[model samples]
Target: MTAETCENGPLRRFLTVSNKLAALGAIGVSIGFVIVIWVQNNHTRSLLYETELQDSIRMTEVIAAQLYGPLRWRKPSIAQDTYDSMITHRDLHVVAAVTLDRQGNVVTTYQQNSSQPFNFQELRLNAGADLRLDSTWTAELDGKLVVATPVTSHDGRKPAGTFVVAWSLAEIDRAMRAMFLRAAFITIVLFAAFTTLSLAIVHRQLSDPLTQLTQATTRIANGDKTFEIPCTDRRDEVGDMARALVTFRENVALIDRLTAEQQQQTLRLSNALEKEREYNALHREFVSMVSHEFRTPVAIIDGAAQRIERRVGKDTEDQLRERTGKIRSAVVRMIELIDSTLSVSRMEAGTIELEAAECDFAALLREVCQRQQEIAKHHKIDLTIADLPSRILIDAKRMDQVLTNLLSNAVKYAPDAPDIAVKAGTVGRNVVVSVRDRGLGIPEAEMPKLFEKFFRASTSAGIPGTGIGLHLVKHLVELHDGNITVDSTEGKGSTFSVTIPTRYGEADAAASAALSA
Candidate 1:
């Protein structure tokens, strides 16, 4: 397997000068726009008020001119009435008057009934401060303007009176309102134009590039390696980003292709490794089985040959014959063990054929127990099967192998204990078979590896074993759609159980048929 490689990760930073400047510029422009609008509004208001004040002062001078001659001054009613009526017609709401005293007092005054009341007191006191219409009063009395002048009776002799005039500032107010409305409209139009231009610029330079990059990233995440981000011609910050994004996406595409190839390579390597491991296991088991099966017989044959050579006398002939019989038994044992191991291998390699004819498990257990008992007699151990009626469907040959393996192991591992129990029962819809031994039990740590090919328990380290017996048994059980497991304790004992589906009926007849195998 190839080791995974590492790479330096990219650091995405959020802080940048152009972004900061854009934020500051936006705030600055908004504030500046508001200031410009305020100044324009105030200037227009000032112009409107000043023009109205100037117009009022010119009209006041015209009224003062009427008092310059005796004819106009002596009978001042006609001139005063004419000017006052003209002022009224102009919708000025003005008061025209002449004073007959030198103390700037209101001696005689003319007023229209509809004009706003003005403060004559302040106008009389402040009239002579400066002559070019210096005294002008606001609506201090009651929403009115007061204009005052000192009169000398138009003869430079009769310090007649101070003229006091009152007028409404409604026209001045109207002019100011119109100016404000016009300025507001202009300000709104300019802001609208500026906002539209700013939005367009943002859309072209910022939004468009970002949207493209976002789409590219989405495509890349969805396993598309052919995503192409368009480049920007802008020279500002967005252009730098567009260049970086396109380059990064190209690199990611290359990495994606490499990663896919690497994944396939890794899968192939993993499969190759698993096949090699299985091959090694089977080869090792074959070599071990050959060694075990040949060693005992070879030793017996060599002993018999040497005994015949040593037994030249008449008393040694019987011993020589006995040794030859022992060697014959050893040879038969070797042949049986070799055949069993080879059968297991053929089954593992998928060459074993199962003739799934009807059979009985109870009778199968009896035959296996009788065989196990015969084998245990050689080691001075006892084997017994729990009583059960033969009533099931099974492959008798395959089940014999499973039971033989378990019984052989129990007797081999627990030679001194001698007691082995074979059991058969039904659990739910399945037939349950168990072989238990009161022997030198398996260690806790080695129990899980018992069904692994060529794996021997720690206690069986010095024992004669090819170690493929349990593995073959487990595989055979699974091929029958069954399960096998063991419960064991290190100094106590072990029980191996196999469960498979049970078919009802055909006990005695099926047992007789399987007995032929």
Candidate 2:
């Protein structure tokens, strides 16, 4: 509503929502892409395993056929070069034989890792026919593929039992290594190409538009609105989102500007209302204080004036003097209240200074107790005092004010209960003085701010108080380098404790001096 508020441009919209959307899209795509790769890798490995199985089986069949048939079951013989060739074969690592009787065994073995020797014995006895393969054993240092097969010798067309061969697993391991390396290399090359092309596509379709949006948002934050983002013709979600965002930003800026103006108007109204209320409160306090102070004195003056006017008709001269003395007492009480008000004002404005002196605290408490006892008797409130031997150095008048304010507050707050206590003792190198009252106590939550100016108890609404008593007490106590603490429970009672350090503790000062020596 003001010209000053209008000078600031449109309010800015937060664009973090856009970054979040992009991040969500990127995360979803990455997870899907990883799952696809894992499935593809599993399928490739399965295919490789099956291919190796078929190839190994076929090679076993071809190699086994070169051995004996059932007709040569008893005796077997083969040429040395023939045995040597089978032993040194590229794909096969061993050749060996065993009789159907468990004691007969012979082997043309490869010079490598050992094969399981029981195969020929076990296989010849178990199916008793064509044995295409025995088993493979892998080498420890370098994988050497080994297999065994039974062989037979043909002599005059007679039958012989078996011949067996042992072989290494080198070729199988080599093929597996090759397959894995190929898959890894191909996968890496394809992934690099895919990522590079995808990044370039994204740069074309997305990054440029997003960059423009970002710059426009920054300009908006800096209170600029003359520039605009170029709208694209693409009919995708991104294009729709860009259009929506531009519209949203336009609407939000207008609403925010209007809201700012409304806030300014509300602040001005609030300040004006606050000042008016403060003026009313000050006027009300002035009237109440002046009236309370002036009421009794005005009454006494009116009664005295009426008496003096009637003295010529009915009264003796001494009776007239007695009435005049009553008027003087009322005036003195009024003067005391006025002085209390003025002293509080001076304390608040930092115009009051202490007349500090090194006085015995014990002697001061004796005097305070003597004076308070007479007042307590009139109010029917018992005043108990104890532990007054502890001494401290402080301003006598200020210390007296602390005790007086606390006593008055307790009496005022607990008039019906009628019991009040004052206790003082040495706690470490400090003296602790406590005022305890059994009365309507303070709430726990209100205890902390009890010493703050103008704060009153929740239950004390009808009570006559200025709410400055505790505030003045706190300042006076602290001026003597003491701290005051309170503990209270609702409906029970309250205690106010003040602790001030000793001016000279005989034991402590002597210990410190001895240590220095």
Candidate 3:
């Protein structure tokens, strides 16, 4: 054979038009099959991981519930028994279980296999497990799953401790590897058959039109909706596909327009909501100020009338003196109320200022206790003072309002429980005053909203209150650069404590100067 004929013999036959089309078809089918296999593998892996995670979480929650009683009662032996009973099952794959108290102290731990000990310190460092016992948490670290859940108190009000469980992921990993191998084997077997079928079916008759439609779809998928699809004129499946692409493009454009309009509407709604919130806040403040302003005058008038009615008879000198004293006390409270009302008004105007001055704190407490004691004649007010300065710089009238409201709440809530304790002391340059009442203590759920304006607790049902006292007290205390806290149990009692710095800038300077002289 000549050189030209030798070069064109088998190579030319293989590169014929029919053979070229077959090769292109086989390549396309192979790409499609690989994508399908990859997507299936990923989906299977995700489902397995999610199932294992959910199982770990459910098991941890069960263990926490079972150990609640043992943890709460401080019975480590019972806690161990609970853990062993629940975690000893081999199918559970529980490597270790740990219980931590509220202070993050490890109360008890159970290990499934002591020979292969689980390193909790490694888990803590690698899995970011710092014992956040407020909520349920789960993490995957180094082929292991960790699940932690809060063990709530008996009342289900708060978390008393945390229960943690670790699960071995070896079985899951092995199952995934087996699945992947099976998928690979099946894919290899099916690829040859699929390529042969695609090569036979995709000839010149369909390849050109399908390729054109594919390009048009790719452009549309890339967010170019203006590209005109081809081959719609022919009465064939390719023509039908082209028409469908046109319709899809139109739908996408319509959806885009509608999304833009919806976003505009959402923006308008958000602005309207913000305006409504501002108006509501201003309206509530106005209402609270008006209500308190009216209440003080009414109380003063009632006290004056009561004294007048009681002293109707021919009274002795001592009785006349006592009546006058009671009338003056009522007037003094009325003046204090006016001052507080002005303070609230200033606070609303955003210009509130504290009138801190040297005032006798012990005497003020005694006076407030006396007033409340007389008002709640059925209840006894016990006052205790320790290590308090003789005089501290404070807004005397505002402080009076603070103390009076606390004492009044104590009296009003604890109607049956007669003894209300008021304790005051100095701690590290701060004065702490606490009011304790054996009344219907606030529910745990309602504690967060205790100082919210117009928010009354569930326990305060049928009580004559506006739920503004504590809110106002908090605002006044904050103006003095102080904070207030409440400790209460549902049926036990409540303690409202206020802590304020004893030395203001001016007071500290004056004391320094006095010492220097």
Q: Highest lDDT: which candidate?
A: 3
TM-score of each: 0.49, 0.42, 0.45
Each model's C-alpha lDDT? 0.66, 0.59, 0.77
- Segments in model 2 whose C-alpha atoms lie over 4 Å from true places: 1-283, 286-290, 293-336, 372-385, 389-391, 504-517
Candidate 2, position 342, lDDT: 67
Alpha-carbon RMSD, candidate 1: 12.0
Clashes of each: 7, 31, 0
Estimate the Cα RMSD of every predicted model relative to the unseen true structure.
12.0, 23.3, 48.7
Poorest 10 consecutive residues by lDDT, candidate 2: 137-146
Off by more than 4 A, model 3:
1-342, 506-517
Q: Between the candidate structures 1 and 2, which one is better when assessed by TM-score?
A: 1
CA error at residue 169 for candidate 1, angstroms: 33
334-441 per-residue lDDT for model 1 (tens digits): 765776688776976889765566776666676767765654565543344453345555677777877877888988888678777767776776788777887778
**lDDT per residue as tens, model 2, 380-421:** 334344554444566777777777667767776776777778
